[model samples]
Structure formats: C-alpha cells, structure tokens
Target: MSSFRVMRCQPLAREAGSVKKPLNHLLVSAFVYAGLGVASGLFYREFTKLNGFPEGAFTQLGLAHTHLLSLGFFPFLILLGLERAFTFSASRKRFGWFLGLYHAGVILTSAMLIVHGCLTVLGLESSAMISGIAGLGHMAITAAIIVLFLALRTAVRGVERPAAVAA
Candidate 1:
C-alpha cells in the first residue's frame, strides 16, 4: 500500500465554512416522512369509512402508507447515518441535487397515490395522467439514487486509514 497520512480523512464539519446542514436536513426529512406516513394511514381509514368503501378492499392509500414509511422515512434515516459517517454532503452540489430530486419524487409519488386512492374510494375513474406523473416521479427517484451512489463513492474514495507510527 502507499504511504498514508494520519489526518487524511477529516469530517466536513471540521473543514472551513462547513456546517451540519446536511445532517439537519436529513433529520427533518425523516421526521416529515414519518408524519406523512402516519397521516396517510389515518386518512386511508377515515376516507374509506366516510365513503362507505367495503372493508378488506385494496386501495392505493394502504400502499401509500407503506411506501411513505419504507421508501421515504427509512431511507432518510439511513441517509442520515451515512451522512454522519462519511460526510457525503462534502459534495455540496451533488448532495443538494439529490435531496431536491428525492424529496420531489417521494412527495409526487405519495400525492398521486392519495389522489388515486380517493378516486377509487369515491367510485370515480382516474385519468391516465396520474399514472404517468407517478412514473415520472419514480424516474426522478431512480436518478436521485444514482446521484447518492456517486456522492457516497466520492466520499468513500476520499477516506484513508492512518498509517502506523514507527516505534
């Protein structure tokens, strides 16, 4: 292996002009997703009851609750841990883009699910446009995943183990 420096990998917060902005953002996103997930669950129950929808019937609202909790809340929590560990936000531009795209995708996808669910409960047919928009949201999520992978790769590449000191 090549020679290593003791202080090679420094936390971004320790760097000049750096802050914990990414961590804070990630934490807030996790909480927001958690809230959304709970609210969607409640909405599913209440809306179906109000509409006299049959019990045990499948609805997009149920899926939305799971999606919000699994895809939105869990992912954000995981990203928070990753950010704390690797400081991937050091790649500021990429991180920002990833955050914006990811949040947009989650919100768009969940919103469509809620709308479609309501339509179904009300016995109304949904337009193809809703499905199309959800597809676009999924695409955005896919792109955000790629961006996150690249950012994590960059952060990992920047990290180096300290060399042992000679006796």
Candidate 2:
C-alpha cells in the first residue's frame, strides 16, 4: 500500500492533431445508417398492414431497426463525441480497422435483414444462404464492437486539468 496522490500523464508528440478523414467517414456512414433505420421502420409498418405477411418476416425487419441503430448510428455517434475529446489519430491503424469492420457489419446485417424481410413478405421460407449471411454479419458486428472497445481503451490520453483546477 502507498499514500494516495494526484498524478498527471501527458500526451506524446505523436498523439497529436485532429484528423478529418476518419471523422468524415464516420459521420457520413452514420447518416446513411440512420436513413436505413428510418426506412426499415416505415417498411415494417406498411408490411404489417398487408395480409399474409410472414410472421418471421416481422422479426427480420424488426432486427433491421435494431442493428442499424445499434451497429451503425450508435458507435459512430460515440466516436464523434470522442473525436473532440481525444486524438484517435494517435492510433490510426486501429481506428481505421474499427471503422472498416464496423461499416461492413452494419451494411451486411441491415442488408440481410432486408433480404429476409422481403422473403417473408413474398411468403418464401428462409433458406440456408440467408441464414449463413446473417450469421456472418453478426460475427462481423461482434468483431467490430470488440475493436472499438480496444481502440478506445488504449488510445485515450490522460485528462488535462483546467487552469482554474490546477491553480
């Protein structure tokens, strides 16, 4: 055991600068995902009103809403906030991977959900291919989430004190 004391950790020289490219990609992708979420909701509502809508189809479209917002909008929105607070470019490679995997997962999951929903509407049974694609999408999403957590966990710089606080 040791006496408690306040300590400071400084940002390194390389952990510098605001990067626009990643932020742009995050924002743009979020907007698109947001749109897809809204669109899926609309489709879900309309699809329900029609007779003989496959019961399973409802579940699939419902997931579109969930995955789009959670996988797409959620992470990007958090990253946008993080952008102002930390220099994520400090770990550019990791951040790039997070963005890539995340976007792909969001796209795949939502696309698969849409495909499944359409099949339900058409009264077609879900096939092996659809199930396989959905499974892969889920895996990608899980991987992306892990990457996001790891990237943020290590990349954050120690909090700097304000002049008033320091004084």
Give each model's whole-structure lDDT: 0.87, 0.72
- Stretches of candidate 2 exceeding 4 Å from the true structure: 1-18, 47-57, 157-167
RMSD of 2: 5.0
Candidate 1 Cα errors over 4 Å, as ranges = 1-13, 165-167
All models, RMSD in angstroms: 4.0, 5.0
Give residue 98's lDDT in candidate 2 (0 to 100): 74
Worst 10-residue lDDT window for candidate 2 reads: 8-17
Weakest lDDT window of 10 consecutive positions for candidate 1: 8-17
Write the residue-wise lDDT of candidate 1 on 85-124 in tens digits: 7888889889998998998998999999999999999999
lDDT of 2 by residue, 64-116 (tens): 88778877777678878776556564577877787777677778878888888
